[model samples]
Target: MRLNHALPPDGANGKPVGKEGDLVVRDDELGALGNMAFDLHSQLSTTGDLARQNTFDAATQLFNDGLEAGSALTVLHDAWNTKLGTLKEACAHISNHLDYSKAQHAKDEHDIQTGMKNAAGKAMTVSRIYDYIK
Candidate 1:
């Protein structure tokens, strides 16, 4: 007959077989990655600013030419400029969201620790009730 002890089994040499359902997250590493992405996008915005300005300056000069006022090329240039503006806005949003995520992750990690401590305390209190009842 086999007896079932409550404690988990240990591997060879009496070391505990690795914990089950453990989620080990390296938040510091993740936050650093997010910060790097944010910094890269900020640099991209600076470079894009100069490029956009040059592009618009050329487009305006072309549009100002009397021969091209009614040309389809002007319309195409305007559409492209609109799309570029939207793309820049999207990049800014991405950077902002990543910054927010990094802050939230830190908050979440703290909350998890607090919750675990509270749960352990409550479990110990409940376990003591059996001794009082006996």
Candidate 2:
């Protein structure tokens, strides 16, 4: 018996499919998102470091002048640094993962196309393709 792999326009669950179908990946968009994440990571690392240092210096000066608020400010600075570090790490992970995904997808597609070619280097027919899938 022939296998019917085609789904209806609305898909098996009756939900409308995307313009390019469910699994389409736009490489350019992925690259753009990755670049934005990398930029955020870089900005947070440099600017966040400068801001933290300035706040720490001010807090130290206040403490030296016998102000109680200096201790509170120091605590605030520490909390802010911890939050900033977490955000920077998340941005770095996103950037790195997207880059790896794009490269890996390209490699997978290359391997699949190479494997599907016949011994004579011609593309496999539709019937032969079904045999592999089955």
The candidate that achieves the highest TM-score relative to the unseen native structure? 2
lDDT of 1 by residue, 47-115 (tens): 645655555666577767754643555576567667757776676676566667767877987666454
Runs in model 2 deviating more than 4 A are: 1-23, 117-134
Q: Return the TM-score for candidate 1, rounded to 2 decimals.
A: 0.47
Superposed by TM-score, candidate 1 places the C-alpha of residue 36 at a distance from the truth, in angstroms, of 3.6
Q: Which ten residues in a row have the lowest lDDT in candidate 2?
A: 14-23
Clashing pairs in 1: none
State the lDDT of candidate 2 residue by residue for 89-122, as single tens digits: 9999999999999898889878786678778988
Worst 10 residues of 1 by lDDT: 1-10
